[model samples]
Target: MKKVILGLSALCMVAFTSCKEDASSKINSENVAAAAERDATSGDFPTITFEETEHDFGTIVNGTPVETKFKYKNTGNSPLVVSNIKSTCGCTVPSDWNREPLAPGESAEFTVKFNGKGKGAVTKSITLTTNTEKGSEVVKIKSFVEADPNAPAKTPAKPVIKQVQ
Candidate 1:
């Protein structure tokens, strides 16, 4: 009779332990799924990564138009969408990029135009809006412009034929 009671107690303990393990496993699974969902919808959807960070336009003569292009890839797993782009000054113009939802393997370009009206070293920036965690991005375009000094002397050394005889 005592043996029978001991055997039944052992079986009950085993069954209870198994049930507790299963319940804990379910809870852990739920937590994992919740974490994944939170990561996905945390408003940090995609990323915009560029191949080149800095661009130099070299030297441009005054009153000329100079432009440069920036290439980039959507390095993240999700699609990258670029919204609005703004230039820091009126002398700098950024061509609008109408392409949307750049896939993980795709690429894009942003063209920046700088009017060589200003003298000395010019530094400008273009701001981009997107669905990234940072919400926006900025790219810099720079150049050195100098006024042309030889543009005014055309007929100075034409003919000095007066006292040759």
Candidate 2:
């Protein structure tokens, strides 16, 4: 019984010592100071300038597809990277965008296709995720879609007339 107790005590001591805080993995003051210095000196963010942020398709026929091109330039000191492009809905698609990083003073263009399926005034927006000062940018497209002619017309009810007795 005494030997078993001694073995148990030795095992507990070994476990406690092994679990002690490791000195080599400790976060020191020097590391914090260096991190602060790096953050303070980092300021070379990219910028994007668009030729036109919005486009109007005027009047379009329903069920027709329309497309437009949006042009942009990197007008900053650093290269601009566009990580993703998303539209307001599946009816709008952004395509042919440059996948590579755009260098300063470089220009690129992308095409946005809209399936003209809605009626009346329709508006959609496209969002771009980029490595720039704003982190993200937005562009818009709008159009007036005419009513589908093939659709059933909504007729008004005829007024009832009552003859005086």
The most accurate candidate by TM-score is 2
Clashing pairs in model 2? none
- As for candidate 1, its clashing pairs are none
**Per-residue CA lDDT of candidate 1, range 1-165, in tens?**
999999999999998777645555557777899999988778646778887766788788887888888888887777888888888899988885855788887889988888877789988888888878788888898788888776675676777678776
How do the predictions measure up, each by TM-score? 0.64, 0.70
Query: Residue by residue across 90-141, what tens digits does model 2's lDDT show?
Result: 9999999998999999999999999998989999999999998779999999
Model 1, 16: alpha-carbon shift in Å? 45
Candidate 1 Cα misplacement greater than 4 A, ranges: 1-40, 151-165
CA displacement after TM-score superposition, residue 41 of candidate 2 (Å): 5.0
Candidate 2 regions off by >4 Å?
1-41, 150-165
